[model samples]
Target chain A: MAEGKFTQETVSMTDAQKKAQRSRNIIIALVLAAFVVLLYFGTQAKLGANILQRPL
Target chain B: MSVEAIETKSDDVLISSAMPGDYYRLMKPRVMYLVIFTAFVGMLLAPANINPLLGFIAILCISIGAGASGSLNMWYDADIDAVMDRTAKRPVPTGAVTPDQALSFGIILSVFSVITLGLMVNWLSAFLLAFTIFFYAVIYTMWLKRSTPQNIVIGGAAGAFPPMIGWAAMTGSVTIESIVLFAIIFLWTPPHFWALALFRLKDYENASVPMLPNVAGERSTRNQILGYAVLLALSGILPAVLGFASIYYGVFSAALGARFLWLSFKVWKNGSENEHYGFEKKLFGFSIFYLFAIFAALGTEAVIMRVIG
Candidate 1:
């Protein structure tokens, strides 16, 4: 068997850059969560109680 | 000596330093506010009752679509934005966000907003939203803005579509009442923007934007402002004339329209020779209040009528 070789690169980020990246990530996560909530509620409102009557 | 140092020495890695706030600013929150307000008014004035959740979704989609267009506009206009005092500090112009990032952000939001609206709401509203983004981004920002003095006049249609979209979201079709709402904004846009252009003549000239004041000269621009102002005043009272709004709203609209015309007259007569352009500034300020007041009056009347009935 041949041995596998791997290389990893690390880039340094400034404090400000890291903070900004963190803020962006948090916002993206929140937006995605909000979208999921909206989708669930929107489906409920749109389909009403009939949503539960679907056949398997 | 570490991996970071080795990577730094081998090649410079460019990481975006853009904060979330910078991304928000790229969306033109102020303009989005106006779009949301007008769209809300349209939804209220719509004859059909809307599901509250659906209505909220519709407004959100419309606002996101508008913001997407604003992002695209900022992306494409970054060069000119850098030259203009008013827009020099925008995210793209100030290096807080790159143009390519802004473009991708806009395209992604535009597609997302449109698709979500279509799937969640009605397709008609989604289509209108899609067209509005296309009009603002492609027609106005990319083409007409650099090419003609009539850019705002034609581009105004994109801004005017929100109320119609809102109405369509509720009713699933366009109607004369919604068209009247659209016409008010359409007519109101020229005078409002021209008032700003009159005061910012030098900025427009510096940017080589061919604003009416820059190309047709201030005199023509002032005359055109007055002309549009007159049309706007009549259009403001159209809801009453057409019997959609109550007499009280009509009287209120009339009074507001009179003030609009009076200010516009001052702007027209004062000419561009005034050192301060005070009348132009006043007109510009009042125009914002005028549109807001008109839409608010209509919305209030709608709510009152619904309550009374």
Candidate 2:
């Protein structure tokens, strides 16, 4: 059966695969952080200089 | 086949492992390309200047949301997909990805796309994106697709939403101009898909999907295709009529619309078996070019105006 093709071992990562996976995870995290920072600044720019200033 | 049967099959001891690329394929990248292109054009056409970074983020989120819908569709339709030759090799059907995994991936991406767009862009566009995903995945894929002959006609609206979302990204609300963009795509869809249905009638029949050709007779579908083509031609010129686009664009859109209608007429006239001269096949191929060309013309017009002014 097609299901039998995917044994637990097939899904399990080897040591090299595990190391590569960790590296990819780290890269994804860093990229996500950069996106957040970019979005924050972009929103601020669009909102203008007194974006955070409140009405008295 | 029921969802339960598919899930039960997926719950086997040895689930098929998927590569990263297999997961990517689940998102239907080809369809996503059209969505991204339309949305990008809408963003460009908007009156306001969007910050480049936010604009990129908006497009990224929209693409992800589109991908999420594609994944969910694959998950739900795995049973029929397995049966259809065209889809038998898809990730879920081929055992490259389990239905459960695809479901989780789709759900996660859907939530992520909506939340990120809402936080980074305006809420209105985000809401539209969320609704597009739901409409495609639930309304179209789960319900209308199997139940109705007008599935493409109705469900086509989901595909038509991206440009509006892009316009909303800039303006924070939809406008008549954006709706014109929506209408263009909405009208273009039936003829395009019906042409394809003419050629792939057997695939739909095997899947038991109530496609227009399968439910209504072929002759009726052909007549409907011609009818939609005529309407599409009229709607295609709206941007010029509405004054957002120049006369040059209007002329060009009208020319493309004319050719589209001609192709539809050709498809309706000759239902012959000749492979190379087959009108249905030609129409199907031209329909793709028709949509791309129309959108590209609009984007080009926008660019020229920006440059000259």
Candidate 3:
């Protein structure tokens, strides 16, 4: 009978890859912020100026 | 004694190596620019006035929708894109973004743009935007492109819908004027694309994509290009003919159309036998300018009329 040896491999992202990932994260954050702003203004425009004047 | 070793899974090492710019490239910015310009013109030419904020929202939605279609196109066509010189460097083809990532991005943007448009603006425009995305992503990219010579001819409708969608965004309905704008783009597509196909016949052949010049032969494609050019030239003046634009615009369009016809004729007569297909290349370049010039003239005329009256 022969005994087998097991080996484990470890991997890490390069600096370039890390920078790219960080840039993508920043862009995603900016886009989400922009989308929120768009929604706020869109709601205001859709509701119009008399939005707050509704009867309780 | 026993020792334990820790290993990182391959997929877990780097979630994604794609840059933000790579994702932007996947969206085909040039094509999105054209869609945005045409849709903006449509909004301006519309009979009813749109609120400025709403109009900006509409254009943003339409542009994002166009970009989403482009991303989906790159995802589905990545294989052929890798073979074609023109598309070889696209994000998916170059491996900057994986196909699954591109697909997810496209689907997410498509849903977001459509839902936002419906919620912020009107449902009709939203529906048109959704349909346009489907037509481009599924009909044009997934089906027609791999199958037939008439791919662009029919697929052109997907591109033509932006202006109609814009008009609907403003007016909440489709009208003859919008249809005329659609027809202008529809008629212009075959010649514009066929001219490119003539120059890049080998690329289509290598990719097994049946472009007109590849399947129909150069002579037939050239003639068809000339035919479409003639139709496009006539359609270019339709807005003026229909009283939507000034007679001065009609004259300007006529001059541009004549140049288009002359270039098409040159391509037809000379054939693609030339080394560079110079005539075809010239016509292709001119066709882009012709569409832009015609749309710019119409949009400018509308603005002037609104200002004066």
Highest-DockQ candidate: 3
- For model 2, residues B109-213, the per-residue Cα lDDT tens digits are 999899889988889999999999999999999999889999989999999999999999989989999999999999988988888887888899999988998
Supply the DockQ value of model 2: 0.24
Q: What does candidate 3's lDDT look like per residue over B178-253, in tens digits? A: 9999999999999999999998889999999999888879999989999998999899999999999889999999
Stretches of candidate 1 off by over 4 Å are A1-8, A53-56, B1-12
Q: What is the lDDT of residue B309 in candidate 1?
A: 70
Reference-based lDDT, residue B40, model 2 = 93
lDDT of each: 0.92, 0.86, 0.90
Candidate 2 error regions (>4 Å): A1-56, B1-16, B272-277
State each model's C-alpha RMSD to the native.
5.0, 5.2, 4.8
Which pairs of residues collide in model 2?
Answer: none
Candidate 3 TM-score versus the reference: 0.93
Q: Could you estimate the TM-score for every candidate?
A: 0.94, 0.87, 0.93
- Residues A1-56 of candidate 3 have per-residue lDDT tens digits of 01112344424456777788799889999999999998998888887987688897
Candidate 3's C-alpha lDDT? 0.90
TM of chain B, each: 0.96, 0.94, 0.96
> Isolated chain A: TM-score per model?
0.78, 0.63, 0.66
For all candidates, the clash counts are 0, 0, 0
